[model samples]
Structures are given as C-alpha cells and as structure tokens.
Target: MTFGWLITRYMYPCFLPMGEWYRTPMDKNGAILKIDLADFQPTQHLDIDPTHHVIVNGLYMPHTVIRHNERLAYCDSMAYRVEIEKNAPIQLQGFTRGLAMTDDTIFIGQSRMRHVLRIPHAFSNCCLDGGIHVYNSTYRISRFVSLPAQQVYQILVLDQDFSLERGGN
Candidate 1:
C-alpha cells in the first residue's frame, strides 16, 4: 500500500495504525459503561440490545482481550448497558460534531465538515476493508439515535477516557 517514493514522504493529515483501542468512557472495572447508537436511518431498524458487549476499535474490553480473539462478536450482558436513542432530527446545517455507537457500529459525524464516518468491526467482518468510510453529508442516514446523556450530564472530551493506549494521538 504505497503511492510511490515521490509522494511517500509527503502527506496530508497522515495517520498511522496502532494495536487499536477506541477512546471511550469506561468503568473503573475496565468495562464499557454505556453505548448508544446514532440512528441515521430512521426508516430502517436494527434489533440490537444495549445490555451487551459491543465492539470498539476491534476490542470490546475485558472479554476481547481475555478470549484471545478479535472476531467481531456481540453478546448480551448485564455488566454493560448498550442503548440506541434518537436525535432531535439531524440538522445538516452548521458544524455539528456528533458521536454515537450501536451494538455493531460506531458513527462519528461532523456536519460542518460535511463528513460522516462509519467504523464497524463486530457489525461487519470485512476487515480487509478496514478503517472508516467517510460519506458526504448529502447522503441520508436517518437511523441515528443518541442517548439522553445531555439531561444527566455534560459531555467533556477532556474528561472522557475512550483510550486504553496513552499518548498515541
């Protein structure tokens, strides 16, 4: 996967891969607290239960590392809570930075940048097609739903701990 020596040394916003650990909120016990999907495709629905261990950057914490396997798998659990809550109608206008995850997929969107990225490990097995798929904002994704986290607490990126690896970014 090279683009010739002339362009190898030069790149824009280049990113290198690590062992893979998605920075997300986790409990002191190393378990994911809760996960909510941003359902962009409202017309369609998924039979996903929130009380399950979902994939995150190819790892779903304790079990994944414990299983000695990284296969995309989902299992119902009471330790962690997985929920899918809807958005208040996606406003395609302005720079809206949104984040949400489902039992299978994780979606991060930047409306201002007009880009939406989808990362799925357990949701999809095409690891050969690894990494995220960025789509233009014009495309429809009415299936996004977020949890009612705002009413309970404010989201602060600095206070969040979605990373298991430190100082990588």
Candidate 2:
C-alpha cells in the first residue's frame, strides 16, 4: 500500500498514476510534483536531492497556471519570474499569476501590483497599466487601452485580435 520513497516524499501515492507525479527536483524546497489535471488529484513532490535533479529556475513559489501552446506556464512568487518549460528562458521578470494565452499574445496577472500584464508572442518584452497593452512580435508596446481594475484574478484571450475580456462563470 505504499511506494516507499514515494510515500515519504509524496502524499497519497497509492491514489495517483506514476506519470502524473512530476519530479521537480530543481525547486528550492526540492522537487515540484504536478498532475495532468488540477482536480484529478492534489499534492505533489519536492525533491531536495541536488545530485540527480534540475530545479526549475525562478520557481520558488509558483502560483498561477497558463497554457502556452502545448506547454504550461506559471509564475514563481519567491523567485520573481514567469517560469515556462518549453520556451525562452527560465524566468522572465516580475512575479506572475493568472495566465491567459491567445494565438499571438499572452497575458499574466501581476501579483505585486493591481494590473494585467501583456507579453506579445512576437516580442520579448511588454507592459500593462490599467486596461490593456498590445505588443508586436518584436516585444515592443504598440498600443494601450484604459481598462477598469478590480484585483484581476485571471484572464483569457478569446481571439487573435489582441483583446482580453474577463469572464468568470
């Protein structure tokens, strides 16, 4: 009824599949356990073994989840950067949560400030103020729109026109 090492490091090992448990050894606490679905099961692992692991960069206190194509991205609060598995570098800059992805653009909710940040797919850097900010493929801020703020919890891109409308049901 126990997986030995899996039970000591991970909780409820008998109830989960082998692949669902992620070995995030790169984390400061050790490893970061993950599941394919949020509701399928909770609780993961943190491998502190420094020899046979590679902790993810800038993922000390990850909080948000955003889908980037086939990859899942999120922000590490303690590390202060957006950490993604498939693209670019480890940490982007500024802590992030509430991830929203579109065809050519991506949006993230800033934890420190009350704003929804925009980072274009084409460009390397972007910004946000009150409403919205549009960025080109070159990572430059091209347009800005005034939007009402209420401590943004999350965002989602409906179409490719660079529009972020909040919807929670």
Candidate 3:
C-alpha cells in the first residue's frame, strides 16, 4: 500500500492541552512510502520534492494520496492544489483534504485551518470556507457545495448503480 507522509516534528498537536503547543521546526520535505504487506516493511520511498522546500506545516502539506487509472494524485492541503501525474497542479479555492475521482469528474473536500500560527501569504487576504468543490476532466470548477462544518476529512465515490439493498448484503 502507498502512504503519504506529513514529515513534521510535531505529529499530534490536537492531542495537546488547550493552551500548550510545540515550537519545534518541521521537516521541509514531503514523501510517499510504499510498503510490502506480506513482510510489513517499506519497499520504496519517494520524496515529493527535495531540491525545493515543499513541506511547510500549514502551507504545503500533503494530506491525501490516491491511485487513479494507474496514475498518482495527491492534495497539498494548505497550498490549495491537487497534483496529478504528468499534469500541472490544479488550483482550488480552499484547504484541500478529501479527494475522489471518476472518469470525468473530481471531488475535493475543503476545510478551514485549525490553530495555524499565521495564514500563508498566498491566502492571507482570502476567505476560505468549508465546502465540496467538484471539478471537471478539464480541471475546471464544475460545481461547489458549501458545508456548515469546519472540516471535511474524507470523500468516497459510489457507483451509479449502487443501492442500499446491495450494501446491506
């Protein structure tokens, strides 16, 4: 299985007490690890970007990665972009989290930053709300549905013929 790495010093800030926090510096690189299930060991490790600084706690974090049609696609949460294999990164309007794709559509979940020290310069003046942004095959925003919650962690695609009766079995 493939796993995306956050590559940070502080792994769980949410588990800390209300007023307490960690001030350690985070690693400035992102990586994807491929593990062998039979032996439970890592077989490969690919850095997202090593030459250029690509990992920032709240700016360029890799949140999710998925394989679609034999190609890899992932979200850069705070950077508000989705990087697909052999294609330019698709820009989004908010912090990207969940991601699902079909033959002609891409669904992305947006969320608000929690406990961020400072807003990134690229989005300092922008108001990013939680929502589901749907994109077309050509990488255009086809639709957007604003959600009432502060965060959306995951998204799953269901087939057109899927039904409750089939799921219960």
Q: What digit string (tens of lDDT, one per residue) describes model 3 on residues 31-97?
A: 4333323323257653433223322233255666676786667787656778787877888767788
Where in model 1 is the C-alpha error above 4 Å?
Answer: 1-30, 34-59, 62-83, 86-124, 134-169
Better of 1 and 3 by lDDT: 3
> What is the C-alpha lDDT profile of model 1 across 101-162, one tens digit per residue?
34334333322111123222223211211112222234534343344322111112243456
Which residue window of length 10 is worst by lDDT in model 2?
1-10
Clash counts per candidate, in order, are: 21, 13, 0
**lDDT over C-alpha atoms for residue 97 of model 2:** 45
lDDT: worst 10-residue window of model 1: 1-10
TM-score ranking, high to low: 3, 2, 1
lDDT of 2 at 40: 35
Query: Against the hidden reference, what TM-scores do the models get?
Result: 0.16, 0.43, 0.65
Q: Model 3 segments beyond 4 Å from truth? A: 1-28, 41-59, 160-162, 165-169
